[model samples]
Target: MATTALFFLFAGFAIACAVSMVYHRNPLYSAISLVGVFIALSCIYITLAAPFIAAVQILIYAGAIMVLVVFVIMLLNLEDDKPLNRLRYLYAVGGGLGLILLVQTFFIFYAVMRAPKQTVDADVTVGKTLSIGTAMYTEYLLPVEIVGILLLMAVIGGVILARRLEQPKLELVVDNELERRGEGEIKDEFRIRL
Candidate 1:
Protein backbone atom coordinates (compact mmCIF):
# COMPACT_ATOMS: atom_id res chain seq x y z
CA MET A 1 0.00 0.00 0.00
CA ALA A 2 2.80 2.40 0.92
CA THR A 3 4.65 1.58 -2.28
CA THR A 4 1.56 2.12 -4.38
CA ALA A 5 0.87 5.46 -2.69
CA LEU A 6 4.45 6.63 -3.11
CA PHE A 7 4.42 5.48 -6.73
CA PHE A 8 1.31 7.48 -7.50
CA LEU A 9 2.70 10.57 -5.76
CA PHE A 10 6.01 10.47 -7.56
CA ALA A 11 4.37 9.58 -10.88
CA GLY A 12 2.02 12.54 -10.66
CA PHE A 13 4.82 14.93 -9.69
CA ALA A 14 7.00 13.67 -12.55
CA ILE A 15 4.22 14.07 -15.10
CA ALA A 16 3.30 17.53 -13.84
CA CYS A 17 6.90 18.72 -13.97
CA ALA A 18 7.32 17.24 -17.42
CA VAL A 19 4.29 19.16 -18.63
CA SER A 20 5.61 22.34 -16.99
CA MET A 21 8.94 21.85 -18.71
CA VAL A 22 7.20 21.76 -22.10
CA TYR A 23 4.80 24.61 -21.51
CA HIS A 24 6.88 27.09 -19.51
CA ARG A 25 7.90 30.01 -21.66
CA ASN A 26 11.04 30.88 -19.71
CA PRO A 27 13.96 28.63 -20.62
CA LEU A 28 15.40 28.78 -17.10
CA TYR A 29 12.07 27.83 -15.59
CA SER A 30 11.64 25.02 -18.07
CA ALA A 31 15.10 23.70 -17.28
CA ILE A 32 14.34 23.78 -13.56
CA SER A 33 11.08 21.97 -14.15
CA LEU A 34 12.86 19.34 -16.18
CA VAL A 35 15.28 18.82 -13.30
CA GLY A 36 12.34 18.43 -10.99
CA VAL A 37 10.86 15.79 -13.26
CA PHE A 38 14.13 13.90 -13.38
CA ILE A 39 14.43 13.95 -9.60
CA ALA A 40 10.88 12.64 -9.24
CA LEU A 41 11.61 9.85 -11.70
CA SER A 42 14.70 8.95 -9.68
CA CYS A 43 12.55 8.70 -6.56
CA ILE A 44 10.12 6.42 -8.36
CA TYR A 45 12.98 4.17 -9.49
CA ILE A 46 14.20 3.99 -5.89
CA THR A 47 10.73 2.93 -4.73
CA LEU A 48 10.86 0.14 -7.29
CA ALA A 49 13.91 -1.36 -5.44
CA ALA A 50 16.28 -0.45 -8.30
CA PRO A 51 18.78 1.44 -6.16
CA PHE A 52 21.59 1.35 -8.71
CA ILE A 53 19.40 2.81 -11.46
CA ALA A 54 18.07 5.41 -9.03
CA ALA A 55 21.59 6.44 -8.09
CA VAL A 56 22.59 6.79 -11.73
CA GLN A 57 19.41 8.75 -12.50
CA ILE A 58 20.07 11.20 -9.69
CA LEU A 59 23.81 11.48 -10.27
CA ILE A 60 23.82 11.80 -14.04
CA TYR A 61 20.45 13.17 -15.13
CA ALA A 62 19.30 15.32 -12.25
CA GLY A 63 22.71 16.38 -10.96
CA ALA A 64 25.14 16.85 -13.84
CA ILE A 65 23.09 17.03 -17.05
CA MET A 66 20.37 19.33 -15.79
CA VAL A 67 22.93 21.64 -14.22
CA LEU A 68 24.62 21.91 -17.59
CA VAL A 69 21.33 22.65 -19.31
CA VAL A 70 20.50 25.35 -16.83
CA PHE A 71 23.95 26.89 -17.16
CA VAL A 72 23.75 26.89 -20.95
CA ILE A 73 20.32 28.49 -20.94
CA MET A 74 21.49 31.20 -18.56
CA LEU A 75 24.75 31.82 -20.44
CA LEU A 76 22.88 32.25 -23.69
CA ASN A 77 20.50 34.75 -22.05
CA LEU A 78 17.65 33.16 -23.93
CA GLU A 79 14.37 35.03 -24.28
CA ASP A 80 10.99 33.37 -23.70
CA ASP A 81 9.14 34.75 -26.71
CA LYS A 82 9.62 31.76 -29.02
CA PRO A 83 8.35 28.31 -28.13
CA LEU A 84 9.31 25.18 -30.08
CA ASN A 85 5.92 24.60 -31.66
CA ARG A 86 7.03 22.78 -34.79
CA LEU A 87 5.38 19.37 -34.74
CA ARG A 88 6.01 16.55 -37.21
CA TYR A 89 2.78 14.61 -37.53
CA LEU A 90 4.47 11.70 -39.32
CA TYR A 91 6.91 11.16 -36.45
CA ALA A 92 4.10 11.33 -33.95
CA VAL A 93 2.02 8.84 -35.91
CA GLY A 94 4.95 6.43 -36.26
CA GLY A 95 5.73 6.66 -32.54
CA GLY A 96 2.10 5.99 -31.64
CA LEU A 97 2.00 2.95 -33.92
CA GLY A 98 5.24 1.63 -32.41
CA LEU A 99 3.91 2.03 -28.87
CA ILE A 100 0.70 0.21 -29.78
CA LEU A 101 2.64 -2.69 -31.30
CA LEU A 102 4.90 -2.90 -28.23
CA VAL A 103 1.88 -3.02 -25.94
CA GLN A 104 0.32 -5.78 -28.04
CA THR A 105 3.55 -7.80 -27.91
CA PHE A 106 3.68 -7.50 -24.11
CA PHE A 107 0.06 -8.64 -23.79
CA ILE A 108 0.68 -11.63 -26.04
CA PHE A 109 3.74 -12.66 -24.02
CA TYR A 110 1.90 -12.29 -20.71
CA ALA A 111 -0.95 -14.47 -22.00
CA VAL A 112 1.36 -17.20 -23.31
CA MET A 113 3.57 -17.43 -20.19
CA ARG A 114 2.19 -20.12 -17.90
CA ALA A 115 2.24 -19.68 -14.14
CA PRO A 116 4.70 -21.82 -12.11
CA LYS A 117 2.87 -24.42 -10.03
CA GLN A 118 5.71 -24.76 -7.48
CA THR A 119 5.78 -22.87 -4.18
CA VAL A 120 8.69 -20.40 -3.90
CA ASP A 121 10.70 -19.63 -0.74
CA ALA A 122 11.45 -15.90 -0.36
CA ASP A 123 14.18 -16.47 2.28
CA VAL A 124 16.50 -18.18 -0.23
CA THR A 125 16.70 -15.09 -2.38
CA VAL A 126 20.16 -13.50 -2.34
CA GLY A 127 20.70 -9.96 -1.05
CA LYS A 128 19.65 -7.46 -3.74
CA THR A 129 22.97 -5.51 -3.79
CA LEU A 130 25.10 -8.69 -3.74
CA SER A 131 23.49 -10.26 -6.79
CA ILE A 132 23.07 -6.99 -8.71
CA GLY A 133 26.61 -5.83 -7.94
CA THR A 134 28.07 -9.17 -9.04
CA ALA A 135 26.20 -9.07 -12.34
CA MET A 136 26.98 -5.40 -13.06
CA TYR A 137 30.69 -5.63 -12.23
CA THR A 138 31.25 -8.94 -14.02
CA GLU A 139 29.09 -8.52 -17.10
CA TYR A 140 28.52 -4.78 -17.56
CA LEU A 141 31.59 -3.21 -15.95
CA LEU A 142 33.22 -1.94 -19.10
CA PRO A 143 30.07 -0.43 -20.52
CA VAL A 144 29.28 1.17 -17.19
CA GLU A 145 32.73 2.79 -16.95
CA ILE A 146 32.50 3.96 -20.55
CA VAL A 147 29.13 5.58 -19.92
CA GLY A 148 30.50 7.36 -16.86
CA ILE A 149 33.45 8.67 -18.85
CA LEU A 150 31.11 9.86 -21.61
CA LEU A 151 28.98 11.71 -19.08
CA LEU A 152 32.05 13.38 -17.58
CA MET A 153 33.19 14.48 -21.02
CA ALA A 154 29.75 15.89 -21.77
CA VAL A 155 29.79 17.89 -18.53
CA ILE A 156 33.21 19.35 -19.34
CA GLY A 157 32.11 20.16 -22.89
CA GLY A 158 28.94 21.87 -21.68
CA VAL A 159 30.89 24.01 -19.24
CA ILE A 160 33.36 24.99 -21.94
CA LEU A 161 30.62 25.86 -24.42
CA ALA A 162 28.64 27.85 -21.87
CA ARG A 163 31.63 29.82 -20.70
CA ARG A 164 32.83 30.77 -24.20
CA LEU A 165 33.48 34.51 -24.44
CA GLU A 166 31.27 36.65 -26.63
CA GLN A 167 32.94 38.50 -29.49
CA PRO A 168 33.50 42.22 -28.76
CA LYS A 169 31.86 44.71 -31.08
CA LEU A 170 34.05 47.42 -32.57
CA GLU A 171 32.81 51.04 -32.40
CA LEU A 172 33.81 53.63 -35.03
CA VAL A 173 34.07 57.13 -33.48
CA VAL A 174 35.28 59.65 -36.06
CA ASP A 175 36.53 63.05 -34.72
CA ASN A 176 34.82 66.34 -35.66
CA GLU A 177 37.85 67.48 -37.77
CA LEU A 178 37.76 64.23 -39.75
CA GLU A 179 33.96 64.60 -40.21
CA ARG A 180 34.41 68.18 -41.49
CA ARG A 181 37.15 67.04 -43.86
CA GLY A 182 34.96 64.06 -44.94
CA GLU A 183 37.93 61.80 -44.22
CA GLY A 184 35.91 59.24 -42.29
CA GLU A 185 34.75 56.17 -44.15
CA ILE A 186 31.58 54.72 -42.59
CA LYS A 187 32.32 51.05 -43.24
CA ASP A 188 33.15 51.40 -47.01
CA GLU A 189 30.79 54.35 -47.61
CA PHE A 190 32.77 57.61 -47.99
CA ARG A 191 31.32 61.12 -48.29
CA ILE A 192 32.85 64.09 -50.09
CA ARG A 193 33.17 67.46 -48.30
CA LEU A 194 30.85 70.14 -49.75
Candidate 2:
Protein backbone atom coordinates (compact mmCIF):
# COMPACT_ATOMS: atom_id res chain seq x y z
CA MET A 1 0.00 0.00 0.00
CA ALA A 2 2.82 2.37 0.84
CA THR A 3 4.64 1.53 -2.39
CA THR A 4 1.47 2.03 -4.42
CA ALA A 5 0.85 5.40 -2.78
CA LEU A 6 4.44 6.46 -3.42
CA PHE A 7 4.15 5.37 -7.04
CA PHE A 8 0.97 7.41 -7.51
CA LEU A 9 2.55 10.41 -5.82
CA PHE A 10 5.60 10.38 -8.04
CA ALA A 11 3.53 9.65 -11.14
CA GLY A 12 1.24 12.61 -10.43
CA PHE A 13 4.22 14.86 -9.75
CA ALA A 14 5.82 13.74 -12.99
CA ILE A 15 2.66 14.49 -14.93
CA ALA A 16 2.31 17.92 -13.37
CA CYS A 17 5.92 18.75 -14.13
CA ALA A 18 5.52 17.59 -17.72
CA VAL A 19 2.46 19.79 -18.14
CA SER A 20 4.26 22.73 -16.53
CA MET A 21 7.21 22.21 -18.84
CA VAL A 22 4.92 22.36 -21.85
CA TYR A 23 2.80 25.24 -20.56
CA HIS A 24 5.64 27.59 -19.64
CA ARG A 25 6.36 30.49 -21.98
CA ASN A 26 10.01 30.96 -21.13
CA PRO A 27 12.53 28.36 -22.27
CA LEU A 28 14.40 28.44 -18.95
CA TYR A 29 11.21 27.86 -17.01
CA SER A 30 10.34 24.98 -19.32
CA ALA A 31 13.80 23.51 -18.78
CA ILE A 32 13.45 23.84 -15.00
CA SER A 33 10.08 22.13 -15.17
CA LEU A 34 11.71 19.38 -17.21
CA VAL A 35 14.26 18.93 -14.42
CA GLY A 36 11.42 18.52 -11.96
CA VAL A 37 9.88 15.92 -14.25
CA PHE A 38 13.20 14.06 -14.35
CA ILE A 39 13.45 14.09 -10.55
CA ALA A 40 9.90 12.78 -10.25
CA LEU A 41 10.77 10.03 -12.73
CA SER A 42 13.81 9.18 -10.59
CA CYS A 43 11.50 8.85 -7.60
CA ILE A 44 9.22 6.60 -9.65
CA TYR A 45 12.22 4.47 -10.59
CA ILE A 46 13.07 4.21 -6.90
CA THR A 47 9.53 3.14 -6.10
CA LEU A 48 9.86 0.46 -8.80
CA ALA A 49 13.01 -0.91 -7.09
CA ALA A 50 15.41 0.16 -9.83
CA PRO A 51 18.10 1.97 -7.88
CA PHE A 52 20.67 2.03 -10.68
CA ILE A 53 18.20 3.52 -13.17
CA ALA A 54 17.02 6.02 -10.55
CA ALA A 55 20.56 7.15 -9.84
CA VAL A 56 21.33 7.45 -13.52
CA GLN A 57 18.11 9.39 -14.08
CA ILE A 58 19.12 11.86 -11.37
CA LEU A 59 22.82 12.11 -12.26
CA ILE A 60 22.91 12.04 -16.03
CA TYR A 61 19.51 13.45 -17.06
CA ALA A 62 18.45 15.64 -14.13
CA GLY A 63 21.93 16.82 -13.14
CA ALA A 64 24.32 16.93 -16.09
CA ILE A 65 21.97 17.20 -19.09
CA MET A 66 19.65 19.78 -17.50
CA VAL A 67 22.64 21.88 -16.50
CA LEU A 68 23.88 21.76 -20.08
CA VAL A 69 20.46 22.72 -21.44
CA VAL A 70 20.04 25.60 -19.00
CA PHE A 71 23.59 26.75 -19.67
CA VAL A 72 22.98 26.68 -23.42
CA ILE A 73 19.73 28.60 -23.04
CA MET A 74 21.58 31.24 -21.03
CA LEU A 75 24.50 31.30 -23.44
CA LEU A 76 22.19 31.78 -26.43
CA ASN A 77 20.16 34.44 -24.54
CA LEU A 78 16.82 32.95 -25.61
CA GLU A 79 13.58 34.85 -25.13
CA ASP A 80 9.95 33.77 -25.27
CA ASP A 81 8.57 34.04 -28.77
CA LYS A 82 4.95 35.05 -29.47
CA PRO A 83 2.14 34.42 -27.02
CA LEU A 84 0.25 31.11 -27.09
CA ASN A 85 -2.98 32.67 -28.34
CA ARG A 86 -1.63 32.23 -31.87
CA LEU A 87 -2.02 28.47 -31.39
CA ARG A 88 -5.45 28.61 -29.71
CA TYR A 89 -6.99 26.58 -32.50
CA LEU A 90 -4.58 23.71 -31.89
CA TYR A 91 -5.57 23.53 -28.22
CA ALA A 92 -9.24 23.03 -29.14
CA VAL A 93 -8.25 20.10 -31.34
CA GLY A 94 -5.84 18.72 -28.73
CA GLY A 95 -8.50 18.58 -26.02
CA GLY A 96 -10.07 15.53 -27.65
CA LEU A 97 -6.67 13.78 -27.81
CA GLY A 98 -6.01 14.64 -24.18
CA LEU A 99 -9.33 13.06 -23.15
CA ILE A 100 -8.40 9.89 -25.06
CA LEU A 101 -5.03 9.75 -23.33
CA LEU A 102 -6.64 10.15 -19.91
CA VAL A 103 -9.05 7.31 -20.63
CA GLN A 104 -6.16 5.11 -21.82
CA THR A 105 -4.18 5.88 -18.67
CA PHE A 106 -7.18 4.95 -16.50
CA PHE A 107 -7.65 1.65 -18.32
CA ILE A 108 -3.93 0.85 -18.05
CA PHE A 109 -3.94 1.45 -14.29
CA TYR A 110 -7.10 -0.70 -13.94
CA ALA A 111 -5.43 -3.55 -15.82
CA VAL A 112 -2.28 -3.25 -13.73
CA MET A 113 -4.31 -3.35 -10.53
CA ARG A 114 -6.09 -6.52 -11.68
CA ALA A 115 -2.92 -8.24 -12.93
CA PRO A 116 -1.18 -11.01 -10.94
CA LYS A 117 2.23 -10.38 -9.44
CA GLN A 118 5.08 -12.33 -10.98
CA THR A 119 8.13 -13.70 -9.17
CA VAL A 120 11.55 -12.62 -10.33
CA ASP A 121 13.80 -15.35 -11.69
CA ALA A 122 16.65 -15.84 -9.23
CA ASP A 123 19.00 -17.05 -11.98
CA VAL A 124 18.86 -13.82 -13.99
CA THR A 125 21.26 -11.07 -12.92
CA VAL A 126 19.59 -7.64 -13.10
CA GLY A 127 20.65 -4.06 -12.27
CA LYS A 128 24.29 -4.93 -11.57
CA THR A 129 26.74 -2.36 -13.05
CA LEU A 130 29.15 -5.14 -14.07
CA SER A 131 26.47 -7.14 -15.88
CA ILE A 132 25.07 -4.02 -17.57
CA GLY A 133 28.54 -2.97 -18.72
CA THR A 134 29.27 -6.45 -20.05
CA ALA A 135 26.01 -6.55 -21.99
CA MET A 136 26.53 -3.01 -23.33
CA TYR A 137 30.02 -3.83 -24.54
CA THR A 138 29.30 -7.34 -25.89
CA GLU A 139 25.70 -7.52 -27.06
CA TYR A 140 24.87 -3.83 -27.67
CA LEU A 141 28.31 -2.62 -28.79
CA LEU A 142 27.25 -1.62 -32.30
CA PRO A 143 24.16 0.26 -31.16
CA VAL A 144 26.17 2.00 -28.43
CA GLU A 145 28.87 2.98 -30.94
CA ILE A 146 26.18 4.28 -33.31
CA VAL A 147 24.59 6.40 -30.57
CA GLY A 148 28.01 7.79 -29.66
CA ILE A 149 28.67 8.68 -33.27
CA LEU A 150 25.28 10.38 -33.55
CA LEU A 151 25.97 12.43 -30.41
CA LEU A 152 29.38 13.40 -31.77
CA MET A 153 27.80 14.51 -35.04
CA ALA A 154 25.21 16.57 -33.19
CA VAL A 155 27.95 18.31 -31.17
CA ILE A 156 29.91 19.03 -34.35
CA GLY A 157 26.78 20.46 -36.00
CA GLY A 158 26.08 22.69 -32.99
CA VAL A 159 29.65 24.00 -33.10
CA ILE A 160 29.36 24.72 -36.82
CA LEU A 161 26.08 26.61 -36.32
CA ALA A 162 27.54 28.65 -33.46
CA ARG A 163 30.62 29.62 -35.48
CA ARG A 164 28.64 30.70 -38.52
CA LEU A 165 29.23 34.48 -38.85
CA GLU A 166 27.36 35.03 -42.09
CA GLN A 167 26.98 38.76 -42.49
CA PRO A 168 24.16 39.40 -44.99
CA LYS A 169 25.17 41.74 -47.81
CA LEU A 170 22.76 44.68 -47.86
CA GLU A 171 20.67 44.93 -51.02
CA LEU A 172 21.35 48.35 -52.54
CA VAL A 173 18.30 50.09 -54.02
CA VAL A 174 19.81 52.12 -56.81
CA ASP A 175 17.23 53.88 -59.10
CA ASN A 176 14.39 51.96 -57.30
CA GLU A 177 15.96 48.67 -58.56
CA LEU A 178 17.47 46.18 -56.15
CA GLU A 179 21.20 45.60 -56.63
CA ARG A 180 23.33 42.96 -54.88
CA ARG A 181 26.32 44.66 -53.27
CA GLY A 182 29.58 42.93 -52.42
CA GLU A 183 29.91 41.66 -48.83
CA GLY A 184 32.81 44.05 -48.17
CA GLU A 185 31.03 47.08 -49.63
CA ILE A 186 29.20 49.32 -47.14
CA LYS A 187 26.23 50.90 -48.96
CA ASP A 188 23.66 53.44 -47.70
CA GLU A 189 20.75 51.01 -48.11
CA PHE A 190 19.79 50.60 -44.44
CA ARG A 191 16.59 48.69 -45.30
CA ILE A 192 17.59 45.02 -45.26
CA ARG A 193 15.52 43.15 -47.84
CA LEU A 194 14.75 40.14 -45.73
lDDT, each prediction: 0.77, 0.81
| TM-score of every prediction relative to native | 0.56, 0.66
Q: Local error of candidate 1 at 37, Å?
A: 1.0
Candidate 1's displacement at residue 107, Å, is: 6.5
Candidate 1, lDDT over the whole model: 0.77
Ten-residue region with minimum lDDT total, candidate 2? 172-181
> What is the per-residue lDDT of model 2 for residues 93-118, given as tens digits with 9 covering 90 to 100?
89989999999999999999999998
Residue-by-residue lDDT tens digits, candidate 1, 1-194: 99899999999999899889877889899999999898998898777666667788889998898898989998999988563367667668878997998899899888768655564344333324666778778999999899999999998998999885653233223344456677655533532322
lDDT of 1 at 172: 28
Worst 10 residues of 1 by lDDT: 167-176
Give residue 127's lDDT in candidate 2 (0 to 100).
Answer: 57
